[model samples]
Target chain A: MREYIYMDNAATTPVKDEVLEEMMPFFKEKYGNPSSIYSLGQTSKVAVEKAREQVAKSIAAKKEEIYFTAGGSESDNWAIKGIAYKNKKKGNHIITSKIEHHAVLHTCEYLEKDGFEVTYLNVDKDGIVDLEELKNSIKDTTILITIMTANNEIGTIEPIKEIGEIAKSKGIIFHTDAVQAMGNIKIDVNDMNIDLLSMSAHKVYGPKGIGALYVRKGIKLDSLITGGGQERNKRAGTENVPAIVGMGKAIELAYENLEEHNNKLISLRDNLIKKIEDSIDEIKLNGHRTKRLPGNVNFSFKYIEGESLLLSLDMVGIAGSSGSACTSGSLDPSHVLLGIGLDHEIAHGSLRLSLGDFNNEEEINYVVEELKKIVQKLRMMSPLYDKLEGEK
Target chain B: MYSKTVMEHFTNPRNVGEIENADGIGEVGNVKCGDIMRMYLKIEDNTIKDVKFKTFGCGSAIASSSMATELIKGKTIDEAMNLTNKAVADALDGLPPIKMHCSVLAEQAIKAALLDYSKKNNIHIEGLEDINFDDDLHDHDIEE
Candidate 1:
């Protein structure tokens, strides 16, 4: 069988063995509903509560503060809309960065249609949101500030702690979609003064369809889903017991070896970036050199489109992703890349190769070797590259 | 999503590169739209002797350009002029609905080249006057 190298961890991750093992009993033997009062149901309730506590502990949040949701998108929607609707009387203004995931951006756009004003702050070329612009965008009527902890495409880590402090000083509710940063970085909600935060399980090597929202105490927003009483009457639905158990174990394992995991990823990421930079000409690194996610390595190879490069990589058993319009099934490329001031052509050529716990030095070396050949091959077929070569 | 033929053409595209001092040259699409096809044709005795293309686009775009160049090679200029975007799409089995515009781009590129050929020779070809290469061929507009 041909060896496959999985590098698109930012997209999703394989569930860890330990997490799967912890969740096995919940699927079959302990299938009772957590809402039931009987012993078997009580066992499931206890397990759910334990997972909630595990999720809370990882982010330095109280056990009662964490509310389990379906996933990150739900958490994002719930946080943004819940705060907006409940506090409509207080304010109608929302502040967010232009580079936020569609979960946040689209939600803000939806709010805009309902007469809500949203300020999309601009970011620097390195994909970092300017604190000055962020501060300037804040208005007296700003009720909430929602920005991602780290970008999904570029992996640029935003100034969450500083942004949190600014929002706190301005008496505005601060929320961060930390789905990408949950396992990669250590987050202290208390220290950061974050009023709300979003996280996902699949990004941290847990099962999909399970996530949690951290709503700081004393901040009461409207309930997300309305149905039978569950999640303290905030989010209403039957709990996903096995997935919750998997998330609990996955998050615990992630935090348990956070330092080692980050170090390994950072090393591999840097090596890949350096090798690609040295080998390929006319390439631009997309995100900040240091103040970025440890696992992310995004670059734009000039004169070649991203989808072709991705196809070439896939043919060599290397899984990768791109910010091109063709890959996204849209007429425009990634908003994050465009937000960072990349023109359509450069943005179309962007490639994101995220590292993870499963990758090794040998895989990185192999990927770099394959990448050099692929870029060269694609460049030769490119009319843009042909023009440049002829000009030379 | 692309057909197997599209992938096959994209993998080993025929007639890649430029024709130096060619009789006609045509370029279509733009970098902003993330697709550009440049075709070079060598015409002699009103027949296309050879054709080559250089494209900077997605897999389907490259495949479309490759297939378009192959369809017109060794054919009369009038024959190449009659090639439609639908024929190019049909020849490749079929492209996804969204990517049908690539076939449109391929058709436009051929006409643009033939137009270039006519302008250079100062001779008019039937059905060539209607084409205006200046109009933007946005990827969203899929031609029938």
Candidate 2:
């Protein structure tokens, strides 16, 4: 068994055994391009449809609504930019939140240069986009409202249903990047009024390089990729049969265990939070205490830095993300942290440990112990820590 | 992962405090961007009597700040002013390429505070006005 402790579930999850099993045959003698006319090709096509059905069933959507893309970024780009271009005659304004993943933000930014106006709403300290703010931001020209269902950085969930409802009343479309929440949380696109939704396979324990966007049946969007007809002419190019197959299997498995998994995850996460909070001083939790995801525990220590904390934990065989992978090299803190009102020092000290199928009490305990030591040692050396101590 | 030296300096940072009624104090960085360094100096008779810094940054950031204070303390104003970011990185065994900027920021911040002190004492800090602190602050801007 692999002894490494993997806490970076939010970044990407390990492929589940069953998902891999479902994907295996697609790579071998059973392999065929889904677009071809031969029998082997037909087999792959049927598999793709079945996978599509499996995905649709999970979210209570029709099979034709799900369009597979390269990943969350591609799906996000397609959704925001695709919809923006296709709906240009309807309106040229879009509403979204400040804490949105760069996928949405960058796409919106790209649209701005093309004559689309975007309103970026601010979130509260816990990272929830306010309903009033959403309503106010909507205008007659507003065509879409894109907000994440759950934050990738702080794990704070926005009120997607309320925001979706508001958008619907105004005759505007609402899209959610549910990449982190899909498998972990039960989402009813119909109930939430999520007209367009996005999910990544890797985030749900499937494979990387495969993701899907849920475009409501009547919604119009220009195809982001122009190529051979595939995905009902919405998405083009060769389908990732193996990865899509794995995604279907993974989604099925995730839904089957969603409740139980969340229960386990919530307990573990809460326990981990408690253990660390009790052990360390000057520690502050970043996300909403209750509205946050079940598996994520994000916190900040006053005197310690996140990279130092991460590397210290890495030394003992633990892996996790500081924040969004997009902003990894930049010295600036995670924008989500800043949006939630954390200044640079504390934000730089932010650490997120997202639990998953692998983490258990023993591992949590080990992390706690190791973390306590690391924080203490790092704080001892921190010039800021010294000053804080001096002030005390 | 980081080197043992980085981990060491990060784990035992030096000059962690604020100077009161001091000769000079300089603060730089938008902490909202994740790295902030405030350098404090106490100079008497043209010799740096005490040097301290409080930095909120990554391992290399804390290490560089610690190294900066350690390098400048007990030195004359000229010697402290002559310190380079390279010296700080070298003292910490060597910072990662991405993190070298942290040391560079620390060096500029140290020089910034010294420049302020020179202005307060009416001494022309050699190359103080000639060197652009704001331009050196380019790396600190959070573009993403």
Candidate 3:
């Protein structure tokens, strides 16, 4: 087998051994429905509650407020739709930024078709939501303010506390899609004044199917999946005991070694970024210099398409991602890149390399060396680059 | 989502770079659509002597351009003009359905260069008049 190097952790992460070990008993030895009236079922129930408490403690929320769901998309859907429908009598307006994941943006778009007003506030060139614009877009009819804690594409961290404060002062419910931020950044519901937050286990090295939504106490959201008494009569489904257990262990491990983990990733990320910048000319970094995720490195090479760059990288056994239209399977490239004021051509050339705990300095060095050669080769075949050479 | 043949061509595309002071030059697609292909040709005695291309697009687009240049390198103008987008795709083993438009762009690029060659010498090439280069073939329409 070829030597492989993975740098696409933002897309998904491998389940850790520790998390898997904690979940093994639930899958076979402790297999029972949490709602059944038996000793075996009771064991499952206790395991589920323990996971809830671990999730809540990680974000400083009440254990009862952490309701398990399918994944981040389901958590986001339930949060926005539940809040919007439950508070429809109060208002029909919803506010969100343009850089949110499709879970938030698409839900808002769907709400608009149902007669609800939505304001997609623009972001700055660094992908930060404008605080003044968010404040001005609010109205008496505004019922929810949903923004992402961090962008998935560019990795720019948003001003969540400020946005939460604005929502609090106006008595509007605030929700943040923190799927990309849950384990990477610290969260305190009360300290940030956040009413609701969405998280996924897979992004934090847990199982893929299980996630949690933090609904502050007394925030009565309409039940999204209504069929059973599960999730305290909110989200209804059989508990995924193994996945829930895995998530608990994963979140605990992430927070336990948060400082060390972040320090390693940040150094590797910055080293790679600096090396690329020094080696390549006419390349633009896509996110904020420092106020971005510790693991993200996004850049747009001036005259080459991202899919070609990604393919070239893959040829060398490196896994990366791109914001190019060809990779997106659509005519337009990443909306997040366009939201940050990049032209279509520039957006089509964007590449994202997200470091993780499994990556090391040796892998980073290998990627940098291979990337320089790939970019040079691709640029040589590009007509746009040919024009630049001709002019020179 | 590419075929093995496509990956091979993309990794080491044939006939890359521009032919300076060529008899014909043609460029198609735009930056907005995320693909631009430029083809240069060297013709002698009514035959294509040399052909090269420069492309800014995806793997399939680059591969299509590479294959198209190789197909027409030593063929007569009429033989090159007879090449179809389907032929180019077949030459590459088959592109993904969404990427078939890259083959279309390849076929158009070759004819476009032939038209440029015809216009420069003021010689009439049969069937070149019916080809409307302005019919912007969008990718969405070809995607299945």
lDDT tens digits, residue span A286-307, model 2: 9899998999999988866687
- The true-versus-predicted C-alpha distance at residue B113 of model 2, in Å, is 7.5
True contacts kept of 1: 0.87
Give model 1's clash tally: 0
Ranking by lDDT: 1, 3, 2
Docking model 3 quality class: high
Fnat of every candidate, listed in order: 0.87, 0.52, 0.90
Task: Residues A297-334, candidate 1: write the lDDT tens digits.
Answer: 99999999999999889888999999999999898999
lDDT of 3 by residue, A1-392 (tens): 55799999999999999999999999889999999999999999999999998999999999999999999999999999999999999999999989899999999999999989999999999999999999999999999999999888999999999999999999999999999998899988999999999999998899998899999999989988999999999989899999999999899888888899899989999999999999888999998988899899999998999999999999899999999999999899999999999999899999999989999999988888998999899899999998889799
Which segments of model 3 are wrong by more than 4 Å?
none
Ranking 1 against 2 by DockQ, winner: 1
> What TM-score describes the B chain of model 1?
0.95
Candidate 1 reaches a DockQ of 0.84
